[model samples]
Target: MHSTVILIEFGAIILGLGLLGRFAGRLGLSPIPLYLLAGLAFGEGGLLPLGASEEFVAIGAEIGVILLLLMLGLEYTAADLVGNLKAQYPAGLVDMALNALPGAAMALLLGWGPVAAVVLAGVTWISSSGVIAKVLADLGRLGNRETPVILSILVMEDLAMAVYLPILTALLAGTGWVAGGLTLAVALSVAGLVLFAAVRYGRVISRFVSSDDPEKLLLVVLGLTLLVAGIAQQLQVSAAVGAFLVGIALSGEVAEGAHTLLSPLRDLFAAVFFVFFGLHTDPASIPPVLLPALALAVLTAGTKVATGYWAARRARVSARGRWRAGGALVARGEFSIVIAGLAVTAGIEPALGPLATAYVLILVIAGPLTARWTEPLARRLAERRRARTPGDPAHGRPAAEEATEPAPVPD
Candidate 1:
């Protein structure tokens, strides 16, 4: 009876998710926010909370995070990561400064302590790479000149996670400085070794993982990623980072094949991950934090746009492209939840999770809208300014011409 109930509940959840995804698709929106809302609806203090399938969903959520990072790693080669790190370090620094500070400040103002502040800082710092990638592709902006600038900032953020997660893990565990330092050192060493191996033996690794049979290829890649992720977790380095490194180690055909085969699984589990996050968060906890979350969202959205704009301008992209780049980087999805989930698990401030949830929900829903409209809005504002300027002929007559001729009739 218990098994039957679990099956029924899990099946219902999956069916609901499929419907939500389809609904989001029709609206030309990313489905992340919908998935999150579905989770809330089925979570504690929700409309229809689940009991039997919670454990299963938890396990699936962990796999989702690992697969998400793995797929992200597959999108870039070691050389590309290295190049972006070098060329875009300044922008990365600027991104951190602009986006991270506001969250930290908010946490401090709330008296959540330095640790929660750090976690909140991270929650706000990183943009949703998955959502942004989809938006760019959907809008046919993948080839836009500022896209590289946007990508570079994201790459740097992901690479930064290799170090950041370990520190966060140590902090959450209440480890001493010595222990934390050791963990950090180990993480750095592993990350460096993986990068070195990827750069030197990526093709060889790919050759080893490559198989003509799709089923075999999928099993091997997925199994290897899970094994590495488990080991990294055991070592306090982070499962996601380990899986990411494994993805980086494989190059050429194997990476592409793995990506193609694993995308559906990634999507399925990623949805589960988001749901699991919401499942644990009490919907009742959100209202109290909603205003703060909204304020933080508004502040961070502007900062993200500024980060993108500065980065794009640094790359010599046009003004419109700069706006696009800024707007594109405004979403905070999986990673924000992942970070908050850690703190929530560690028994941090109870309100932190709710605040993060509210914050992410607002931004994730708003991200696509901003990405689609920011550039055009900026253009319109610019045009209006130009029209009021007598020297700009595009919107109005030149200063000299305006003085020499009667004012044009209103359109």
Candidate 2:
């Protein structure tokens, strides 16, 4: 009877997710926010809370996080990471300064302590890579010149996580400085070793993992990722990071094959991960934090836009591209929840999880809209300014149009 109930409940959840995804698709929106809402509806203090399938969902959520990171790693080679890190380090620093400080300040203002402040800082700091990638692809902006600048910022953030997560893990565990320091050192060493190996032996690793048979390839890759992730978790280095390194280690045909085969699995598990986050968060807890979350969301949204604008401007992208870049960077999805979930699991401030939830929901939905409209809005505003100051000849023409104009065909 218990097994039967679990099956029924789990089946219902999956079916509901399919409907939500389809609904989101028709609206030309990312399905993440919908998945999260569904989780809330079925969570504690919700319309129809689940009991039998909770454990299964929890396990699936963990796998989701690992697969998410693994797929992200597959998108870039070691050389790409290094090149971006070198060329874009300054922009990355600017991004951190602009985006991270607001969350830390908000946490401090709330008296959540330094640790919670650090966690909140991270929650706000990183943008949703998965959502942004999809948006760029969907909008046909992948070929845009400003896209590389956007991608560089994201790569730097992901690389920073290899360092950040271990420290966060140690802190959440209430480890001493010595222990934390040791954990960070181990994490850095492992990351370095993985990168080194990837650069030097990536092709060899790919050949080893490569198989002609799709089923065999999928099983080998998935099993290897899980094994590495578990071992990394055991070492306090983080399972996601371990899986990411495994993705980096495999290159060429193996990485491409693995990505193709595992994408559906990643999507399924990632949805479960988002749902698991919402499942643990009490819907009742949201209202109290909603106001503060909204305020934070507004402030951080502006900051993210600023961060992207500055990065793109530095890259010498045109005005429209800069606005688009800024707007594209506004969404906070999986990483925000992942960071908050850690703190929630550690029983940090009860309100933190709710606040993060509200914050992410607002931004995730707004992100796509902003990406689509920010440039046009900026242009309209500029036109109004020019109309107000007709004498200002520079503002007479659209900045994008002026930037794109061919150097008046030399006579």
Q: Which candidate is the best by TM-score?
A: 2
Q: How much lDDT does each candidate structure score?
A: 0.90, 0.89
| TM-score to native of every candidate shown | 0.95, 0.96
Flag regions of model 2 displaced more than 4 Å: 405-411
Clashing residue pairs in candidate 1 (N, C-alpha, C atoms within 3 angstroms): none
Error of 1 at 171 (Å): 1.2
On the 0 to 100 scale, the lDDT of residue 276 in model 1 is 94
**lDDT tens digits by residue: candidate 2, 282-401:** 999999999989999999899989988998888888887888899999999988999999999999789999999999999999999888888779978888888799689775675556
Clashing residue pairs in candidate 2 (N, C-alpha, C atoms within 3 angstroms): none
Model 1's alpha-carbon lDDT is: 0.90
Worst 10 residues of 2 by lDDT: 402-411
- Cα lDDT tens digits for candidate 1, 1-411: 999999999999999899999999998889998888888999988999999999999999999999999999999888888898899999999999999899999999999999999999999999999999998888888777888899999988888888888999999999999999999999998888878988898888888889999999999999989998998888778898888888888888889999999999999999999999999889999999999999999999999999999998888877777888999999999889999999999998999999999999999999999998887788677767988876765666333232222322221
CA shift of 190, model 2, Å = 1.2
